[model samples]
Target: MKSTTSALLNRIEFPVLLAGLLIAAGLWGFVELMELARAATPHAFDTEILLAFRHAGQPDNPIGPLWLQGAMRDITSLGSTSVLVLVTTATIIYLLLIRRPAAALLMFVAVAGGKVLSILLKFEVDRPRPELVSHLVNETSLSFPSGHAMLSAITYLTLGSLAARFLPDRTTRIFVLGLAVLTTVLVGISRVYLGVHWPSDVLAGWCAGFAWAMLCWLAARLLQRRKVLADSE
Candidate 1:
């Protein structure tokens, strides 16, 4: 039994082990954040962070230079549905062009399934958008989990993992993964800064999105294993 366990552990890559732990951590974080979101008023931390983006008691007046607000809006749009769709479609097409149909399909499933899951989670949480500050953009969605944060994490991380597989070295792989994480963080922060989501909303979204992306990676790994088995047979 010990030998079997050792063999199994050896079979799993370092990234796979790390992903498993992240999945658990993400789920735990989401559950805890959900409880905080259920409160009638935004948490002190949530309100404070949201207000930090604005100028002294002027919710409409965002902090930083005049150009910053516009830049932030553009950054936030990187995670918007239209942009994500376009990126995903382009990636899928590229994968297909490279004759990697399975990879293309997995990418499609990860992003699409993540979207469906995000919608369902929003409905389940039913938290309203932050009323403590004026919204910088128009958004009417239920706001427990920031959709932009969640979907950005899902799409970017999934693509990062996929791209890493093709990259030649560990440094390049890490860089790709880091960029994915950085993009996810930037999107989440942008959501809160815009007052379209509370800090907790973005936190929960990050947790759930990372978890979902890791789960899809694991699923793809399993499918590849099955294909290997079939081929061997």
Candidate 2:
């Protein structure tokens, strides 16, 4: 029994353990945010943060300069459905062209699965978009978990991690992953800045998005170990 336990422990590497912890933390954070979303009144923090983006007396006027609002619109579009679809499709095509069909399929599944999950969570929470401030950009969907934030995280992080595998050096890999995270963070912040989503909504989106991305990564790792998915050459 002691030997068996030792062997099992030896198989659990630090990266795997860290991924497991991140998944747990993400899920717990998401659940707690969901409770807040379900409350009748928005959390004080959510209101205060959302209002902070706008002028003190005028909800219609955002805090930043005109150019900044335009820039935010561009950034937020990075997480838009059309843009994400384009990016995911292009990446999948590239992977297929390189003869990495397994990786391509996994990428498709990760993004598609995240999209469906986002829709389900939005409906489940049934939270309306914040009306405390004027929306800089129009959004019609139910807005508990920002679809833009969650999907951006899932897509960018998945692509980043996958691309990192094919990179030749550690620094390049880290840079790619860092850019992905940065883009995801910007997208989330843009949602808030545009006053289309509450702060909690973005937070929930990040939690769920990170968790789902990590879950997919862990699954891919397992499949590679089992020879079900070929490792990147």
- lDDT tens string, model 2, 87-206? 999999999999898889889999999999999999898999999999999899999899999999999999999899899999999999999999999999999999999999999899
- Who wins the lDDT comparison? 2
lDDT string, candidate 1, 1-233, tens digits: 99999999999899789989999999999999999999877789888888888988798888899787788899999999999999999999998888788788888999999999999999998998888788888998899789999999999999998899899999999999999999999989889888899999999989999999999888888888788412112
In TM-score terms, candidate 2 sits at: 0.96
Candidate 2's C-alpha runs over 4 A off are: 1-6
Among all candidates shown, the one with the greatest TM-score: 2
Evaluate all candidate structures by whole-model CA lDDT and list the values in order: 0.90, 0.94
Show pairs that collide, candidate 2: none
- Span of ten consecutive residues with least summed lDDT in model 2: 224-233
TM-score of 1: 0.94
In model 1, the clashing pairs are none
Error of 1 at 49 (Å): 1.0
